[model samples]
Target: MSQLIAPHGGHLVDLLVPEAERDALKHEAAGLPGWDLSPRQLCDLELLMTGAFSPLQGFLGRADYESVCRDLRLADGQLWPMPITLDVSSEFADKVAGAPRIALRDPEGVTLAVLEIADRWQPDREAEAQAVFGTTDRLHAGVSWLLDKAGPVYLGGRIRGLTLPPHYDFRHLRLTPREVRAQFDKRGWRRVVAFQTRNPMHRAHLELTFRAAQIAEANLLIHPSVGMTKPGDIDHYTRVRCYEKLIAHYPEQTSMLSLLHLAMRMGGPREALWHAIIRKNHGCSHFIVGRDHAGPGNGADGQPFYGPYEAQELVALHQQELGIQMVPFQEMLYVQERAQYAPADEIRPGETVLNISGTELRRRLHEGLDIPEWFTYPEVVSELRRTHPARHKQGFTVFFTGLSGAGKSTLANALMVRLLELGTRPVTLLDGDVVRKHLSSELGFSREHRNLNVQRIGFVASEITKNGGIAICAPIAPYAEARRQVREMIAQYGLFVETHIATPLEVCEERDRKGLYALARAGKLKEFTGISDPYETPESPELRIDTSEMNPDEAVQRIVLKLESLGLIRPRD
Candidate 1:
């Protein structure tokens, strides 16, 4: 008999068919209707097929879904915190209705599995948000996804996996639960502790994990999520490189590193319990539950979605039932007097402690500031620097929004010329008229079409920013929501500066350079901004200029000054 603990619920559930049966299923799937899996669905499917989410045969049926949402348990009374459902668009749901089975395809159109449909329903997203994440506010990233990004309908069924998703990068470290358990048995690791993290591991994290392992007297498993985490997080490629460098610091043979392709919901306490269950299934006896584990930061009210110790408390409450012990993460601090690290509660008062927060570290990286050796390894810092270069060396986007005839194009031209004069980086100007003619020639001025056009521009701008080039965009982006979406898209790669040309409608009409306002006033043009259509003003922008009071050159100078202050450009000597 194996010395390691048994899989959750007495056995691991493997959805993949036997090797002998794969050929038959593959042939049958070709004639069936197919649903392309989204990124989150893909992650869930992988875990389901690999037995990481043991006892879950496939997507949750309506009964289990409602039970999981309301009571954090399945209809069978199993301890399942998160709901695992396959959401789909309404059109796909209708097409697949009453079908015996449907193929599940990846983005590349390769069928990975066949789902035998059992139930379908439209989820009450608001209720699910309140029950699971404790909030329905869009400021929460998970809530935003539920409300805005998720499909309208959910389909539940049993999945017959043909093959796991192909991962070309880091294949060795991506071990399934069964493979991980086999390794544990082979190494005779009786008791193992799992540390789950989505962020890059630094000195504090290293110390925390080391101490956790020592306290539990167990082998350490440094398992980080490589799938979709919170937005604006460091890319997994960079994070994995950092993890590889940090692992060498641990005692040889005491630690192992693995990657979990988990699409995190950032549900705080509930997510903590779910993680503990997952680790238990992976042959771990102890799991780390940190302060604000899986938290999605603050809400729209500027208050944290979950308390600091809520996750730890929740995990501890179900420790025995989960078949895994909860290891509470203690905040580590560097002591200047002793030149060593100590836990927060163990440190003496006024001993000159030092710590760097994630925000502070990001600021340092953004400004090319130094990150001391005590905070992280030099190799990790080098990898971070390669991805997040100094602000002046990085690409950025400057977006100007205002009413038509507000001198946006004029100011954009002047700013473009000024930036070109510096000759430090290649600059691309995407004026409203120019984009309308070339990129969005088929698009109309309808709300949907306009938003689509703006999103297309945002996509292009994001690409430019990602490639270390500057993009200057000038458009009558009257809707705040569309502009906000553009800002988010650009911000993921580099800096996004929103400049509001706050020129009044009357002043814009007085200029009337394009005769657009005249046409709108004469009722020749319909659905025109500042006439028939509303121009939702920006609540807060990086810079706001009213051309009625400022000239083009002066406005451009102010923008340049703002960029310099933001460290995107160096000041003249």
Candidate 2:
């Protein structure tokens, strides 16, 4: 083993306040303004304090931020690829604008660090998005978060860490950058190759990583991010369990597993570079850069934001400066006849090949289809099945939205009764009027208030689905955007069936079960849908029923049939 790779900026920077001085720092922070750090910010602080992001002493100042956004370099010309700034709301910015120092606290109000406020400003976030991410479309997850979730102003300064955020689970598996470097040194692993992944490793991943390590003649570091990832990805706990199962296949002492607390930006090429820098800080001499590494998938136009090989090319361009070798991930296919994985290009002519895509894997899991052992370890498949049961066994939501007299509640009641008779799963009915009386008693009829009410219903439905129960919600959720938001929220846990009761306004007014239509017409109900407020028709709905054409029973039967076809339910014998 030779000398270990140096930190990104020529020296490791540890910002954790020494144990002897932590008490004093706490005393000093007591009088300062405090910010309860978000989960993403907590990840950033941990990396900074542990020297994982060594070149970064703290959050980016205005100068460094502007430089990084304009050019993928720090103000001092170091090859730093991403901007790391503390974002705060306008109100919070005002509160801490002139403060000399501010405390960074966890959600439980424990101080984690103290920031010496050096610069604060409102950035041109649109420009920053374009320069860094190549697009400002909301379809891109990172850009959507930047524009919607991030605060209005940026705060930057150096930080004196008081403590690392507490992690109750995976305590033994969590290793700080310094701890990993120490372990590598003790094991005489100077040449280490690190693999960064957010998904569960199938045989494809295992073969790719093994080949990269062999090529580099380096020890393997299975560093997977435990922080936020793509919204629909499998949870970290299940992923970690899968990793643990696959680790037995590797030669002992030649490979190790550690969790990385990184809230990925999904910045594609730039993210790949950032990963390399961080891996180098963790004493890795080689980092694997795969096709579309860290990419957030296609945008609204159905095209990828970057070329497939773009990440590999960018990492190769800066490999010399980065001091980390770039390991290009080759396309590997499972050879059916050979019963092994081989590089796609190197396969002999006419050899049968089988490939499993992420989408197909999810479909197989949902439909209780076979996931061949050649694709992944049987133990890993079993763990995944424990968490992700077949759709017929999982909970789901049936959201019915329509005009006031559109028979949504009537059809919902019928559906609820039918589902209960099946006795297959627990069923909860959340009628719009009933929920308004209990859950949203004091809410008004403003757009914001209506959205909030729908969000509340979505939250409850998501919880029910997560616990393997059916949540049937019938609400006059007039806005399509609000419905889309709820769908996204519930999709994280289980299936969301959006049923549109597209009864015509004339027919609904004629039925007038609630007489709310008369009040809306008389101006008594100001913001009523189909009168004063508009109902944005759903462009796509799982099932659309018109009460005029069919009775509530018939509509319920149609919905049940759709669910059966989707593998969400089994037809009664």
Candidate 3:
């Protein structure tokens, strides 16, 4: 046990000697003696300054230290040292859910630059920040300068750049077993159990959590992350409040709720292991590790960050290493018959409760529609509605994925026109060709080149979505992995409906409409999808449109349905 939280060999023990030696140790550990903090230690320190600020400041800083300031900028008038939380060093994730961004805008609100801070600098801090933020100023120095926009430049982690939503997501959200246990104990409640998630709270989440608590005879801790969660994540503060509101539905004596500010590394099993350990520290007696705990996902160009069940399996393997007992959960699907969440296998073949998603729910809330109690309790929906306000707040984007010459552009324009007619929200269509022209002007059409092109488009689309504008993207996005990756990313800001234009290869070829197919056949085109190379259909598109089967008007209507299903639009009056 001493080793578990033990101070290390030579200096860690020596540093504990007395206050006279503390300052010397602090300087030496930072400089000559070289006591590099583990990724976890660094992360904890960051949280000390952010989440546990009051307590930590009292301990670490002089009594005169008032509070901490978040954003610090540079000479260029940009928020220079974009904040770095622990998520990067630990999970080494590419994303942090609900992390707020420092919009690099002038006084006019027109964006000139945007900053996104990832996990700790991979190599030396200087070179890495230079590469990521495109500047070499140490973040600490930038912080000392104070940000340009001034006035609490939005704390929390970063999901997207200036192009993202207004609120920082719960990018480093965490809830440990120890914390849960503490909260529970304070309330005189024992048998604490945590509900895990990578998404905002929805009816399904509610149902499952309720069931888990009831079955285990434990008080529920609606624990969710603001870490590297699902891309289109609800802001952690909002979700935390949402859970708080939902807690009222539970027996007051049987439920407790709190927040966890932890980073996501997107390292699947390791992520689950990390989660369990954190929960143990939080004093939770039991933690529910579901199908995929802390699964941030991987794009088409990369392998899945981890396997399905990999997280659960890892938790099982490390059960002995943890202080918390594990509560293994099955994939809970919405059961239509009961109009509640149930284990996927428990559902009758015919039951259906308007199967939908938190993603869809957010869309609906944005559009200002009444979410049925069958889907989520009125209190929960109200919380979401208040936070998201959908079409009114900065809206999100529409991204289309299909083959070249598959009419993605035509359909995107069609959707854009319709969205424009709906009024209010601004729309930006980032066609693959146009985006390539902007981002990859110097590059050619190679596989690696194409991947970069779509990635750039995805980033922009995410920003548009974050800003609450309708960003429509028509990228051939041939790789299934790449399309999925883009979808996950855009999800951070808004809805990402993978509209698979399942226009048969034959149809696309015949349309060679651009004559590109013929060129590919004749070797005039290289890396052309469905030609010398290939195109992978989406594993399960949110909505599959057959441009070959339906008229453009019909396609648009189908799209409207898709948007409605996703809660992006209210039913046409």
Candidate 4:
């Protein structure tokens, strides 16, 4: 008679096969058609198999998908806010058509489970975006991923798990719902409040979460989402180190830490409700809903996708039905005069309050500025610094894009030489013609192939930037979408400075160093940018150099100044 809140839908669903059966299933899976899971899909499958998603046995069929999207409920009326789908390429869908089961393998080709296909169909993604995220804007990270990254068809089936996905890091903290429940039972703890986060925990977060537990009269679970969160978020490795340091400051026997491999949709209100259900399944009796929980920042119109308090309100409405209490997160502020932290609602009108925004903290980190002791622990700050060193010490990419013969390569070469002169970090030049001959020799001048070529350069540049090296890229990226994608990729690891060589097309043709313009004029070359194809000028580049107005030496100086201004390089006295 253990008395933790019953798992969502009354019983925890364990999809893992018995040890005796695993060997047979694994053997059979090798002969079946296999689909390698993407990172997000792997997260979903892990939870579904381990009962973190207790009511879900497998990916949703069309009926359940439609039901959840429309009303935030399954076809049978179970409250499930997010759709758990297994998206596949059209080729895979066609290859496995009419198959009773398909093998689901990890990226390393290890068989993890067998999916008994009950349904397969192409979903109307536009409708899904509107219903789940309340927006059709691609600027919304969730909507952007759904439209651009997800596959063409979705597979729905019951999963017969042979084993859980392997996680080499944080093995001790990755607990299944059953394991978490057993821990609660072992500790004689009944009421537990779960705090969901994807960011590093600071002093303000510590106070807020402690107050939340006190209000709920329960133990606290510092559960963080380690799966796919918003892009540009602090990497999980650094954030986990911060969490580990912060956890030691909690009152003994009052809190514990666990990791959740959840692929968050950043669905705001709906996502809040979804989080509550997940905590409920994890044996928590209370769940914290913060301001704009899981929100994906501003929309394309520059308005918030969801109101600040919308998530709290939605979770409060369903707490009773969810069998969990909603613990609204109170904004914590440091009162300088009182020398203590206080909730925003309780602080006196005259009290001098202080708080550091995430943006401000990042700025301080970038400039190697001081972070006050009152804002965060020294241990946590040390972890952040270890990963994010000051901008001048970190790696970065300088990407030059423009029309042919716009002096992009010359500028890049000069910049590389100047950087190498400083002897600070290794510099690699990825010139367009050089990369084409070495990296993308098979690619063509078609729009798709051109975008792929630029993406390949971006990938290499990002790797260089990640390894504390400078990468100078010179390419005629032309398309805005491709450039945007490249910027996003490199930005994840280090600074990405886009320098637009805004030389006029007439000047570029006149230079004609490679005779490309002459061939395009004679129609010998098709899909030539600035001739037959379009070259979308960058709306906002870090530096706009008109080579026609200045020599390559002067253009390189302008780029060096731009980098210095950004604190990526030291300014000369």
TM-score of 3: 0.49
Candidate 4 per-residue C-alpha lDDT over 1-573 given as tens digits, one digit per residue, 9 for 90 to 100: 012344332577778888888888988999999999999999999998888887888999999999999988999999899999999999999999999999999999999999999999999998899999999999899999999889989999899998889999999999988788888888888899999999999998999899899999999999999999999899999999999999999999889899999999999999999999898888899999987899899987899999989999988877778978899976789999988898788999888999999899999999999999999999999999999998898999999999998989989999999999988899999999999999999999999999999999999999999999999999999999999999999999999999999999999999997898999999999999999999999999988999999888888888888889999999752
TM-score between model 4 and native: 0.95
Comparing 2 with 3 on TM-score, the higher-scoring candidate is: 2
Scored by lDDT, model 3 comes in at 0.56
Task: State candidate 2's TM-score.
Answer: 0.94
TM-score of each: 0.95, 0.94, 0.49, 0.95
Q: lDDT of model 1 at residue 269? A: 97
lDDT of 2 by residue, 1-573 (tens): 012244322456888877889899999999889999998899999998888887888999999999999889999999898999899889999987689899999999999999998999999888889989999998788898888778989999898998999998788889987788878878888789999999999888899989999999989999999988888999999999999999999988889999999999999999999999999888889999987899898999999988988999999899889978899976789998888998877789899989998999999999999999899999999999999999899999999999988999888888888988999999999999899999999999999999999999999999999899999999999998899889988998998999999999999999886798899999998998999999999999998888899877788889999999988899861
Flag clash pairs in model 4. Answer: none
Question: Which regions of candidate 1 are displaced past 4 Å?
Answer: 1-10
Best by lDDT: 4
lDDT (Cα, 0-100) at 457 in candidate 3:
90
Clashing pairs in 2: none
Candidate 3 runs further than 4 Å off: 1-226, 229-233, 240-259, 263-383, 390-396, 504-515, 546-551, 571-573
Which stretches of candidate 2 lie above 4 Å from their native place?
1-10
Worst 10 residues of 1 by lDDT: 1-10
Looking at candidate 4, what is the lDDT of residue 529? 96
Taking the candidates one at a time, how many backbone clashes does each contain? 0, 0, 51, 0
